[model samples]
Each structure stands twice: as C-alpha cells, then as structure tokens.
Target: MRQALLLALAALVIVSCGRRGPQPQAVEPQAFADTTPPSIIYPAFGDADPHPWEDRHPGHYPVHGLDVSRWQPPIDWRTARASGVSFAFIKATEGGDFADPKFDEHRRGAQAAGVPWGAYHYYYFCRPAHEQARWFIQNVPKGADLPHVLDMEWTPHSKTCRIRPDGRTVRAEAQKFLDILERHYGRRPIVYTTVDFYGDTDIGRLPKTEFWLRSVAGHPRNVYPRAIWRFWQYTGTGLVPGVQGKVDINTFNGTPEAWAHWKAGG
Candidate 1:
C-alpha cells in the first residue's frame, strides 16, 4: 500500500509541473528619436511655393507629421525625418477588398528610418462597416506604435459608392468599425474626417473617440466650429524633403511633451 501511494504522489507532481502557463514574449522597445538637423531644405512642389497653406506659424505646434498614399511619390523617410516630420500615417487599405499596393514598402521603410507610423483605412460608405474593419485588420499588422484611423469623407463623386447613407446610419457604421479596430489593436482608433463628412454625419458627438480633422483652408476651429480635434491636417499640397510631388501636412494639437506622452501610449 505504501509503494502504491508513493507512485501516485510522484505522478501528480509531474503532471502539475508539466501544466505551467506559457511564458511571456519579449517586445523590443520602439525608437522615437528625431535626428533631422535644422537648415535642411526639403524639396519644393513647384515655383509657386508648394507649402502656401501655412496659415499658422511653425511656433504654434512643435510636433508635425504627414499622411501619405500611393498617389505620393516614393518617400525618402530619412530626409522626411530630418525635415522635422515626427510621424506618418500611411494608407493601408480601402473598402472591403482593396489593399494599398505600397503599404508594405511604406511601413517597412518608415520603421527602418526610425519614423513612427500608423495605418489608415479609407472607409467605403457602400460597404458594411464590419466587413471593412475585418479587411483592414487582415491587412495591417498588430502592435503598431500609433493608433489606427478610419478615414471617412463624402464620396458623392465616388465611382464605386456614390449613394450617401443617412446620418444615423453613417454614425452607426463608424461606431462598429471603431469598436472592431479598438478590440483587435488594443487601442482606441482615430476618426479622420473632412468638413463635409463632419457636417453630414455629426461625428463630433462620437463618444470618447479622438478625431483627425481635415480643414486645409483654415484652422479646424473656424472650419469645424466647436468640434474637438487631436490632429489637424492643414495642407494637402505640402512639399516635404525626401518626398516627390505633393504630400499632406499635419500637426498634433499639443506641445512636444504632450505629444511624447501620447506617443508612449498614455
């Protein structure tokens, strides 16, 4: 009887030891250092001064960034960084089935050049929000340093989706997309909007979500009028160094220290 009891105890000990939980994986810290020196002349768009939309002075916002898509020429991220571009939002996907062909190159190049980048999806009003959200999730990788964005705008002229949904329907669709992305990425997503879309959908009342407002003609305060904005895209015809053609210029709505805190996932 004593020998049998000893064997049973030994078996139990082995079983318990074998059932240990999985070990945690190590995550490498992301680099956010800006090494671009002052006095570096960025490329110009044309003889007309490519950046003519500088309604506000550079001293107003210490942190600046840009948004890019395939329409922009191949980017020299190193030069962009040196030109004081602190971050970038790269177009990753659109609609339900369309993925940006240059997404992989842009993502890899931005990281290699030490630029913090986020992916943005161009929302299609014709498609279901859940389907578009899943498509974006499948395309963009997890654990990105910056928050994902849903670029919503009035596509009255879209060849694909010309029909505009009602304001309530638009708001519901946006909510669904935001929820799905937030759950998958473990961070709240941003809603990018134009003046027309904001007025159409009344997106300013979205609960607990940050906004990236596009008001190229004037400050968001004057254009959006009482709407809260986190990032303000001031110009779409911006000329930055290391980038050919035109690019979109944007600024964070806070000081450099505040931007650092936000970038650190605060």
Candidate 2:
C-alpha cells in the first residue's frame, strides 16, 4: 500500500512538472506594432533630368506607372492612363507555393486597356532556385508585354521568410534563378532590389542582367552601391489619380528607340 501511494505521488508530481513545459522561458511577450509610416526619401523628381523624362504636358512625365498587389483593388486604368500611366508591373507569384491573386485581373485589365504591362515574382532566398523560377514561369504567361522582374529584397516582416541565406549564397541562388528565367522567358529578367540588399549581395557581378533599382532618395548611382541601373523605383506612396491609396512609381532608363531595339534584340 505504501509503495503504491509513493508511486502515485511521484506520477502526480511528474504530470504537474510536464504540464509547465520549460516555463515558456519567461519570454516577456514581445511588444506589438501598430500602423507605421514607411520611410520617405526624395519626395519628388524635381532634381532629376526633366529633359530626358517626357512630361505628360510639359512638366510631367508621360510614362509614370504603378506596381500593385492584390491589396490594391479596383484599378481605374482609364483614369490612370489619363493621369500619365503608360505601364504596370503586377505581382504574380513567390517562392514555389504562393501566388498573387491580382495577377490575372491586372493582366486582363491592362490588356483590355491597351497598356503595356509586366509581371514580378517575389523571391524567397531560402527556396531552391529552380523551384522559384518554375513558380514564376508556371504562373505568368508567355509573350508578356513587359519584362519579368525578380523582386529581391529583405522582407523583414515576411511571414514565411523572416530569415534568409548569407550574401554569397543569396547571390548564387539569384544567379541560378535568373539563368532559369532567362532560358524560359527568352530575355534576361530584371533584378529589382533595394540599395541595402544590393550592397549586401555583390549584385554588380550580375552585369548581364538589367536592374530595376529601388532608391527613393537619390539617383541609383548615389544610392545603389553598384554603378548602373536600367529602371528606377522612386516612390512607393505616390498618390496617383486612379490609385485610391499609395502606389509604386517607376522610370525607364533609355530612349524609345533604345527600348524598341532592346525588345527586338530579345
């Protein structure tokens, strides 16, 4: 009887201790976040070469465009065209599993509106190169109006990829993905990355690929650690006419002739 009672008491003690589960390491429930304003650099293109960029009338540019995800809805392409929007780059997919719901709608809408458009894939540094490339290719259609862009940046708040490979590994993975995309798309995909991410990963080594540099404050020269940039994303909170909330803005790097030749050559 005594031994049974002792065993029962021991089992009870063990059960109670097991329920605690490492005391949860006393983690002080990390503080939460609220709506925060994104960092703003150069708010306007007042200092850029106005002559090279064609203005809608005289002082405005003719090719201002927006890049959007599913979160941005009910795009009024007519109003956007009137407001000088000439192109768009819509989100298509990411990694090898997730796809942006906005891709089909944006593609169809833009085609119907007679606007040039492109597709972008959000890159996951941890994912296999071939898999990620396949994800993009499988989702986005062939003969797309504009070029495909590999959006490579540190998405610190990404629910899936809060962590990434080191810089050297990251670049290697990027190269592998790019090679696959180029083989399939028949043109080298554009590399879209912020200055910090570019600096961290020696992006200059990938010279064959064009870059859609994201530098909100200064020119790609001043901001990007590298020397050359083909496209520039200057704004993410732009208040265009058709876009109800904020939207991204981009600029092409070359003349109309150059654009035509490049497309033809590709």
Candidate 3:
C-alpha cells in the first residue's frame, strides 16, 4: 500500500525547538506523497489536561490526526509524522482579509512528511459567505488529500462581528460556503463546529456534508445526541513531539479499512 511504502521507505526526522527567544527555522521535511494511512495508525500523542472518557476513548479509534494554526508554531512535521500523525487540518483563511501566516509552511511540511493535510476557514459572521469562500480559495491550494473544512462556531468574544443569526440564516450561509468550496475543490467540504454553535444555529441540519464535532468532555453521541459525525475533535491541549505547545487532537470515526476507503473517495 502507498502508506506502507511511504512509512517504510521514508524516515521522517526533525530537530526539536528548544530556544526561548526567536524561533529557529525548522528542518525541511523530505518529499513524500500524501496517501491513506497505514492500517491502525495509532496516535502516539498526549494531552496537557487529559479528559477522562467514561465511554469509548479517542485512542479506541484506529486513525487519529490533528489540527493546527499560528497558535501552535515552529512544528517539526517530520517528527509528527513519525509519531503517527496520520492527517492534519491547517487553518488557512478567516473572514475576508485575515490569512494565517503559517498556512503555506504547514501545508508543505505535512505534505512532505506524507501526512494527508487540508485547510480550514473560520466562519466570520460579518463578511458575506461568498466573499469568505473566495478568500479561502485564494489562499488554500487545490488537491489537498482530505476535503477542506468550514469551522462554524460562535465567536462572542470577537472584537468585530459578534452577531448570531437564527438557525435558518446560519444554515443558509453554511450551505453557500459549502457549495462554493465543493465546486472549487471537487470535494464536499466538512463542517467543524462546537457544541454551543451546534445547539444555537442548528447547523446539524446543514445538508450533504460530514461534520467534525468538537466534544472534548465526552463522545459525540453523548454530546451531539443523534447527530452522526466523521471526525471528532476530542482535545485542544494535545501534546506531540516536534510540535511546540498544545495542539488540537482529533479522531476518525471508523476502522483502518473504512478510513482507507474514505480517503480513496469511495
């Protein structure tokens, strides 16, 4: 399999960041094609403040990955790949003008390390959905291994654009964004959201796309009730080698074969 070949032939390695002041340049990872993960790609990761699972744990899942942005910087992607970082969703554009500084670097590194990577846009209420979609398309390149994500969550603490539309308006806006991205990228975009937003906006009613629910305290079935999900963002305080500070950890809700089939766009 492609994943086995990449894992066996490639020796992903990196230099850990240990400085206090200016962050040093990361060792460039060797080129490797992004492919479906090997069977049972166990997550070799940790959490700063671990949540006790009363039911099925994140580790029980066969495939695991992470999401990162400017907040978790100076990552050694090679080391992360070696530590079973099967896939990654890197934050790209937000609103209209805001772009992530580390997006290009993160995407490249993840690709080179053979980690399937995609970009995500943080939904901003102020901007028009089409404008934000265009902005995201302008930034994140095509041909990402995984489908891109639209992070739809309420930002009440924002300095600008804190307005919360009703569920109908929210779903309409989300569908517009999803339609634009699906047409542009040739893959249906996934929705990443929090419990509160899911409750208020009723975005679960959004059509024809998978959901990546953030339920750190418990399983999605427990938190999201009857809603089905593809990915689960279980923790934000995750720790892994090569990545500085805490990062978001997630799990795929399927077996190795199922994950491979999904990655193949089956």
Candidate 4:
C-alpha cells in the first residue's frame, strides 16, 4: 500500500516553550493522496462545530483541541475550554526515559477546564515493550477521563533512531504497552499513529484496539486498506478562534449516542 511504501521509505520521521526545549526538526513526511471513503467523513458534533467556527473566525475553530509536551507552550486550558476545546492529549512520557515536565499541570488544568483528556508516550522501537509499559504505569496517574495512547512512528532525525526496531517488533512491544495500560486504566487504550506508520506496523493484528489516525486529506478507510479509525485528525495546522495559535483538528466516530457509548464503554 501507499502507506506501507511511505513507511519503508521514511526511515523518516510538535511545538512550544517554557517547560523544555523543542526537539530538532523532523524529516519531511512523504505525502500521499488521501483515498478514504466519504461514508467515513467525520462530521461536526453537538452545538460546537469545527468547520464554520474556523471559517468565520479566520484562525479559530470551536471544539478544537491540541496535544503538547515540554517543547510546547503551557496552554491556557481554561481559555481553551471557554473557547470550546472538548478534549486533549498530553505527552506524559517517552520510551523508558524522558518525561514531559508539563504533564502534571496540563493534566490538572485540562480537568479543571472540564475537558476529557488522554495521555501519550512516544514509542522507542529500541526499548522493550515491557520496559516502556512499566515506565508508563509508574508515571501516569489514574483518572476517570484519561485514556492512554501509543505514539508509533519512524523518527529518522531522532537521537534514538539508530536502534529503531522492525514493524513486527514494534507491534509486539506496543501490544505489551497497551496491555499494561489497559490493566491500569481499566479501559482499552487508543493507538495513535500516522497512516504510514500504521501500515508499516502490524496494526491490523490488533483489531480490538481503537485507532486515532492521522489523515490530512480524507477519511482513514479511503486512505488505508480496511482501516478502522475511531478518530480522524484532518488537519494539524488548523486555525481556530479563541486559541492563541494553530490547533490540531479531529473527528470522533459515530453518532452522539455512539460517542457516548465509546466514552462510557456502555
């Protein structure tokens, strides 16, 4: 597939300030024509809409949300919520080393804003799944709204890239981490990866896991073979009102009730 090809070629590989310095520039990702189906197009939800809000506001989208690590600025969560952010994912830790300093405050602030939250750990292929799982279990706090994520990708520019593991090894380790996270959090963890990364890894093997897919052009199914995406991030540099800068835009799958069921595991 195109994604698989990109992943093989990628050998390849976010933002902001105050807490920790930004990582080095990432390699330019290989672009692919989006071929996802229209039935899977993520529509706006509830009273808060992402399209018109962003269009009318010029740079702001309502219900817009973002993820951050030490390299990114400390977001004004309250402002973000007031402006209409419904959810967020914070970087908690990476591999078996390096924890984001802003995670604690971001977690608290987002909760205070009444936003549903999730946490992500940058995957290091060189690390053992058990080791990384243990690290995540040790650091992230348990909470009602928190879901865990596995950030899998090929980071060619990474200082730690030399030891990047193969896709099968990557899937094995990720599954281990996901299993541990599910045990601690009492919910099936989400898998976050670019289309290319997903195709490169054995993601299809973990069919039970919900996916948080990154597809800039269209829905995941059109772009991927038998894609089962629960979340679709359509844009990364999306301009939204109320927020200070560009924010990532995503669509949750299913209807309102479906969203509720997914959220409550009902």
Candidate 5:
C-alpha cells in the first residue's frame, strides 16, 4: 500500500510539472487604420509644395508643427506623424463659456497618434479674465503633456467684443488669467499674440512669460523687434500632409535638443 501511494504522489508531481500555467492572452493589434473622411487625403497636395514656408525660407528651423480647431477636417494623425509633424496645439475653449466643438476629438486623435499636444484658450476682450480663466479650467482637464497657452489677440473688429481695453487693464487681465492657469497647470503658461496686440498691450514687457508671436509677413525678429519669443506662427495659409485646406504652421525658437527639454516639462 505504501509503495502504491508513493508512485501516485510521484505521478501527480510529474503531471503538475508538465502542465503549463495560463498562457498570456494574445494582444489585439493596435488600430491605426485610417478612418478619416475620404475628402482628407494622406498628402493633401500631390507634386505640390506642401510646406511653402520652408521653400520660401531656405535653411529655416527643422522642427515644424500645426495648430488646429473645428475649422479643419478630420485628420489622419498617423500620416501627419509620419510626415514630420512634431507637436500640435489644439484649440480648447473661447471666451468664458464657449468651447471649441472639435477640441475633444483633436485632443484624443493627437494623443493616440503619439503626438505631444497642448491646449489654448482664445481670450475675449468683453469677458472678464477671471471668468474666462475659470471657464477654461473647468473645460480643459489638468495633467496635459504640454503647457497651456493664452491666445491674446486684438478684438477691435470682433462682432462680439470690440472693446480694446487700455494697456494697464489688458496687462492686469492677462496677469489674472496667467495666474489662474499657472496655479492650475503647475507650469508657466505661454502667451500668444499678434503684432498689433503685442504692441497695443505691451505684452513683451510682461514679467516672466514666454511668447508665441504671429509673424506671417517676415521673421519674428523683424516683426516683433526687441521681444524674445518661444514659438513663431509663420503662416496661416500653410499646406501640410494629413490636413485639409490651409492650416497655421509654426516653429520653435531653439534647437531640437531644447525642444526635447521643453516637451519633457523641464
């Protein structure tokens, strides 16, 4: 009886050793399939100058990116990523209460495509700065990979808010908005402005803030003289792959190494 029990125990041990534990479940292939509208092509223009700015200005900065809103069609982010798009800025909100209709979609698309993206809020001259800041914070969630931007441009011709506040008032309002966003995002927010608004509000004199300047006619040095800039929006009528129609194109001020540091939140 003892011998039989020993043989049975040895058999059980052998069976246990031979049997394999649960195998890992097969991973589903990532779905990078292009589902964008047929109107949106991988290369919007064939045998054409996709990056006119680069052609116009030879030997310019290597890193280039785009800014998009609801005005753009559904984008094939994978194609854009493969076509040399390093980063993106998605418009999230406007004024105090209005949110961009395509904000969520663009944000998600950029993330899934492994692109670093940030959000920007369009400032409304008529709205209170604190209220607009609160609205932006409520709408745009925190922990974004890129720093937030306050798009401060002239509303002189705006049908909604044409009141151009004085320089002091504008600076105060910008400071209020920047303070709120910095506290919420835990990083200094960038300020975007056109030449007219930058001059009107003296945004260059603003303390301890980087600026994204719009200089379509020429380089920022000629347009925004004596002012330091981090990003430069060179053209609004830019042609890029995976983007429908014309889009805004921008470049970083520093080398690719500096961009890596900035993108890493350092």
Candidate 6:
C-alpha cells in the first residue's frame, strides 16, 4: 500500500492543472473514436514527466498527435488511433544515407490503422540539403495523408557535423529542401524546430513556410515570438496508451473545424 502511494505521488507531479478542457470520465475514459462527431476529441493522456503550463495547455486543444522514432518500441497504431491520436509523424531519414529502420513498419502500421500519418526528415548540417531531401523521398513513400516535415535543428553533439551556419545559409538550405519536397510531393512541407535553433537561425524568415514549434516549458507564443505555428509540441515525456515508452506530444493550433479543414489539406 505504501508503494502504491509512492507511485501515485510520482505520477501526480506530472499533471497539467492548467488543462481547462472537458476531461473524460475517471471511471471509464471516453475513447476518441467513440466520441460524438469525432472531430473534437480530447484524449485524456498522462505525462510521465510534464511541464506545468500556466496558459495554452495542450489538453485545452481538442486535437493531439505524436511523433515516433526507433527509440520507441513498436506502437499499437490502432489502439493509439482510437485513443485520440488523430495523427502521427514518424521519423523517416537523417542526412543523406541513414534511414530509420522503423520508418517502413511505423508507416504501414499507421496506414493500416487509418491514422493520418506523415514522415519527417532530421537535418544533418554536414550533408547537402538536396541530398537529404532526395534520401527522404527515396525512403518514405509518396501519397501520405499529411505533409512531410523537415526537422531542422542544431546538432551540437553530432560528431560528423557541429557547424552552425549563419541565418542566411540556414534559410537558403531550408528553402532548397522545402522547394524540392514541395515539387515532388505536391504539398508544402512543415518545418519542425526547437527554441534555440529558431533563435539562432530565425527560420521564420523563410517565405511561405509553415512551422511545428517545440515549446515544452511554455506556450509557443512565449517562446517563438512573431512566428506563426501550426502545431505545438508541448511535451517530450508524454504517456499515451498503446505506446510502450515516453513519446513527444503535440496539439494542433486550431479548433475541430479548423483541424478537419487543415487535415483535408485545405
């Protein structure tokens, strides 16, 4: 009984008291698939390690999704989908060569489960942007339900590439990558970035580009000033049902109607 209490206390520290949305019943939480209208379903997931949000809590947003890599064990995409996981972004490739072994499995799993899934390419500074884009295309198949993402960030610990290019160079490379993907995929890709990288490169300067910003400690408005963001990655240690390990969690920046429209590629 004491051990149970200790476990409960550990879980209690990772709560979003700021979540001001309707929560599922504590007795039997509502499955997102079973929700009425299905457009606005807030899957009341837990966080293994959470950042207390003072405002703009992720739960307040009706739509949520997750990003997965090989670091995570095999995910039960059907279970995840039914549990308010409206979308998924799987890591596909990195640099010009290293393709994630789990990409094919995850992509197929998400598709079979009827989840709106897309692939994202992690940036490598040492590699040419065009080569990286081609590598991603080669690995991730065409005709996905969502736009692909370019994950550009500073790789400080990378042995092969530790060089930080100037804002101009970074912008140029990003544009090249974006344009190539758009031409090939017929959809403008979203750029996923973190705070420090955004601060250094000023990626928002890129023309006609959408962003998925990572701001775990605070709202995107507080971290990414003046930059319009479509998705906000609010936590890295989110605990969702059907996933074996902690995963990154994100929420759409719009209402159910807007989410439907956007996901329809409008």
List, residue by residue over 110-159, the lDDT tens digit for candidate 5.
Answer: 89998888899999888899999999998889867888899998777777
Model 6 TM-score, 2 decimals: 0.84
- lDDT scores for all predictions? 0.80, 0.70, 0.84, 0.66, 0.78, 0.85
Minimal lDDT window, size 10, model 2: 27-36
* Candidate 2, 51-156: lDDT as tens digits: 2422111122223567888988878887777666767889999878999987899888887887788899998876788999988898998878777889998889
In order of TM-score, best first, we have: 6, 3, 1, 5, 2, 4
Assess the local accuracy of residue 176 in candidate 4 as a C-alpha lDDT between 0 and 100. Answer: 83
In model 2, how large is the Cα lDDT of residue 63? 35
lDDT of 3 by residue, 1-266 (tens): 99987775554422233325666433212111112333333554789999888866777776889899988777898998888788999999899999999899899989988899989999988999999999999998888999999999998899998989999999999999999999999999999999999998888877676889999999787888767588889999999888999999898877677787888786
Q: What range of 10 consecutive residues in model 3 has the weakest lDDT sum?
A: 26-35
TM-score to native of every candidate shown = 0.80, 0.74, 0.83, 0.72, 0.78, 0.84
| Per-residue lDDT of model 1, residues 77-188, tens digit only | 9988887888999999999999999988888889989999999999987889999999999999996779999998887777888777888888889999999999999998
Q: lDDT tens digits, residues 7-30, model 6?
A: 898777656554577764322122
Candidate 5 residue runs with Cα over 4 Å from true position: 1-59
Kindly report which residue pairs in candidate 2 clash with one another.
55-60, 56-60
lDDT comparison, 3 vs 5, better candidate? 3
Score candidate 3 by TM-score against the native. Answer: 0.83
Worst 10 residues of 4 by lDDT: 53-62
Q: Residue 89 in model 6: shift from native, Å?
A: 0.5
* Residue 215 in candidate 1, Cα distance off native in Å: 1.0
